[model samples]
Target: MKNLAWLSLGLMIGQFAYADPIENGISFTSGDWEIVCDNTRTCRAAGYQNEDDGTQQPVSVLLTRAAGKNQAVVGQIRLGATDTDPTDTEVQMKINGQNFGKVSISKDGDFLGHLSSAQVEGILSSVKKTSLIDFIGKQQKWRVSDKGVAAVLLKMDDVQGRINTTGAIVKKGALTEANVLPALPKPLITTVKVKSSPVQWNSTQLSQLRAALKATFKSDDDACSMLTDPQEGASEISITRLNDQKLLTSALCWRAAYNEGYGYWVIDAKAPYHPVLVTTDASDYQEGKITSAQKGRGVGDCWSSESWAWDGKQFIHTGASTTGECKAVAAGGTWNLPTFVSTVR
Candidate 1:
């Protein structure tokens, strides 16, 4: 038993160490169960089984507790991708061939049930003594490994900051710290230098600036439409002095769907302005460099961002950060934080 515990600890720590930080999700294996924890510290434990016909199905049961909620843990039997949608149905559960009880499946194909802490303790007792536990839904059957299920549940409890009085499952030593996922770095904000005596543009100069911007996008009708369209939000164009000799101009147009847009542009130098099209989804200028971020669509999504520094003639990519798969949770949008993949300066 001690050897088994040590082996489990080794596997868990090994996974935590080398696994890509970019993959904001932390996963570890105990017996046949694989446990995954998201940035919000909500975790799920799952195990898969293959059918006799060699088709792999989501015949596994998944367990998770709500973030920061220690009242109850929920269990769900995942329906395979190709499985027929289940209407309201009853799922039968058994431990060591003895009937446990029935859990209700919702209309939207969700096979879920709740377990109080006492109920979890009862199940853990059975799992420690049994080898097979079965989940029989109306159209699916999952035979779970008892030891694996027990180990995963213990780890899940740890991840949610729960302590199991029975040392049977609680991790000891360094492995205990692995329960909590690391917090993501704060968002980077660019600092703009404010000028006491800012440069002001007159009507004629402003007209020349507008003409120059329209000319820059002349080759692309879609981009030019942003400056000419009245329905679009007010033109977001501005000019600033980069230094005593260089001047900077920028324009932005926010679109409708998905908050799409004709992104901002930064034109360096003066009239007959040399425009350098900045194509990042979002950007900020600070410390003589442009930092940009591209947000992902959904939780557990990956994001890519970079910083570019201008070197006299052109902007060069100076640093970048990318994250692995991450899923967002609703705890103040904490899961939206991204794990750094790499940083190069």
Candidate 2:
């Protein structure tokens, strides 16, 4: 999964001041407005705003047009992390102070609404003339600039194959009405039974384990430091047998200075002399599989986790989940489980 560390509203928005220029797909920029085509060829235009005190607001507006005929022209308004119930409120859009429409909030806490082709054209035309768009929620407002929107949409059409080299043009049309939004699959829940008893290692065994760990970190200076001088009271080492006679040992070193940690050395019982260091930070191994997680904090906290199975030679990522909403503070939270990405078997 792509790292969701950027989901931290404050940290992410702050970095946007120095964000890199777009390199892939079609990209157009004017003033504070930016439009770009994604890998899927879908085009979206977005604008950001910061408060007078330099504090970043998580509010933004996205205008998207998908490829193909009759594709929906969507307007999306995203807000900062909040525990407020979005379903109880409404979001409105205005072009040049003229009311466009009102929309409901999505499960992701954003307001998304499909627009008619006529509405799209009107908004585009108004932006060119007035160069201002406003998105108003119950208690917040976002002002967007439309300076370069016209050129962006035209280029987007060309990239999406809507424009032919023969100077032909495809007109935008109304989208089909749909009542239900697509739903993401639920995460897999498995309760693997692990051994309740802990293993006791003798002095000779401990020495061998240390030797294995040393060999694993010999070429990694950072890893070596983490293993040797980990943060005070934030280190652990353990040995366990996954199967009848296959013992595995692992270690965790927390480095508070980095707000991160490291785990390494998955030694096989039969090959103790040639231990393999885990390339991925996975832990809680059981039944030939291990789980790993990454998290970030700011105005809201976000996390992504995955489970991988060891197939004798390598670990294969099998399942994954992520917290999509920053304010979803329930146990395990609301996870969006998309199809698993490929992993070497």
Candidate 3:
């Protein structure tokens, strides 16, 4: 069966942050505002152009804030870069038809200059009330709806425990900000140390082993339909030496139009060969890591990928992320938007 990790992300939204020592991540959406937070409690909230404003432009503003007392909220404006995207190199910021000023393009063309402290303060405060936020260019103008800005920012404040604090972006007061959550250091992961080499096993034994692995997919036939279908070969078992006590095994498990997945597991090197499954959506394995990369859609505009490191005894999840908002800016999207980050030794 395909791993359920990807689908689980969406279902896990709004689950409260800093609930434990280390959280994989959390996401939340309110109207046009969406927030994606990482393991370290660094959050990025993105607000998109109004969908019903007669014309939809692929413009968005990202508000990023790290967890800690008195951390500043940084904002950046991103204009779409797809074939259908805007070509304007400059844009004007307006709130309620009042011109804020010209937003100049920096050396990095993806954004106009990032909002200054004064601009950030103004926008956050304005969005909390009934205000029209817009960016007008020579050719086109885009409006970022304020419908959900207040709610989304409020949630951000809550997630970081900034609500009611002087540092809070939503509702600020004289409350002390000394107790706001501090930014936790990133979790560290070490890579697998042993070098893997292939080991040959009896052909009949391989077939039987493959069957056992397939049986592990007893449910989620719809999400992992390939498991229930018999199109895959049964003798596709592959075994490799992971360490002195365990053997790594893999078999073709699923196939899609532009990608295929293999199931990887670990078993006893000796007889009985009790197996423990790792993942069924793995696309490829190398040195000491397994990875999966799949396009978000047929256009190949966006992609999501994950990786695991075979750390000495067991496989450890190392990373999982999607490229930033899929505006067709690049073939696989433009920026690294990781939900999980770990340094491998």
Candidate 4:
């Protein structure tokens, strides 16, 4: 439910982005580092170079740990634009000027392979204090800030119930990892099979459907009110059979410079069509699932998305996530961080 303005303000003022109505799990940020714990309790901590530091390119790191006793804390690194080939270049991490070792290149551009356990441990110890984190490559050196990293990792530890345990990332103690909380099982969702392929409404049905949906809007200024008169010739609607008794519908709701939105609803196939509006800002619909993808800004550097699925009875939120802050790291943003996750059967 957050927008570009709120995201920018939170980062600038060093305010944490708490879980919003759209997001179900824990969403927190502090300084140059932030962490997200999904519904399954898996935590991901991302740290970046201070945006104000213009002298060098952006260098970032990702640390991930699933909820459970003794789960390994995996580390990943990403570098900003460079002149040389990443494969041929040897990228090494240096904590406070101490060389840890080189990290392997990854198939994903700008991202290095998973860090070795030793490298991860070194990072866990160094990131807690006012240390300078650096990733060195040919003609490139990315310095990540240590500010707020300790607080973020501590929060991760707290959420995972790892605090005061041997496996705690920030507050390690004498307690055994067995004392830490176990990972929760992923929520299971049995998807409804599509009874038939997609089909659009005829001209007669289209006009009636539009009028019916317009009636549900709060006012003439509702964003989706564009359904009456789209920027194009007219709005379009798609109908698909959800089951023998119900039908799924989609229609063009609004448009923007680089992105668009759709309205999704569940309705009866016959007259007395009780259109149950799902969302007016959905991005796409397929089979028995509905999804929405929105950009933090027009550049497409940062993004967020959520999904809903039919489970025979009704649509349920399946997942919601966002790439880390829009630091202009890459086109789709720096990381695939999720605030909510689920396993759909």
Question: Evaluated with lDDT, which candidate comes out highest?
Answer: 4
lDDT values for all models:
0.50, 0.50, 0.72, 0.78
What TM-score number comes out for model 3?
0.82
Candidate 1: tens digits of C-alpha lDDT, residues 95-131: 6676777766555534444544443444556654545
Compare the candidates by TM-score and give the number of the best one.
4
Please say which candidate is ahead in TM-score: 1 or 3: 3
| Alpha-carbon runs more than 4 Å astray in model 1 | 1-25, 29-32, 51-57, 66-72, 81-88, 110-123, 126-130, 137-140, 145-345
lDDT of each residue in 1-345, candidate 2, tens digit only: 112321332242344335332222344554455565543455576544433324333344566765555466665555543344334255676777778776555664443344445545556566434455665776665555554455455455455545432221222334331321222232233343434234668777777676667666545455545555444442456777654544556666544432454564555565364776664355466666677666644423455566666555545456654443333222333333222433333
For model 2, the run of ten residues with the poorest summed lDDT: 177-186
Better of 1 and 2 by TM-score: 2
Model 1 — which ten-residue stretch has the worst lDDT?
Answer: 328-337
Task: Give the TM-score (vs. native) of candidate 4.
Answer: 0.83
Error of 1 at 68 (Å): 6.7
lDDT of 3 by residue, 180-204 (tens): 9888777788766665899998877
RMSD of each: 12.2, 10.4, 6.8, 5.8
Query: Which stretches of model 3 miss by more than 4 angstroms?
Result: 1-22, 81-86, 106-113, 219-228, 231-235, 257-260, 324-331
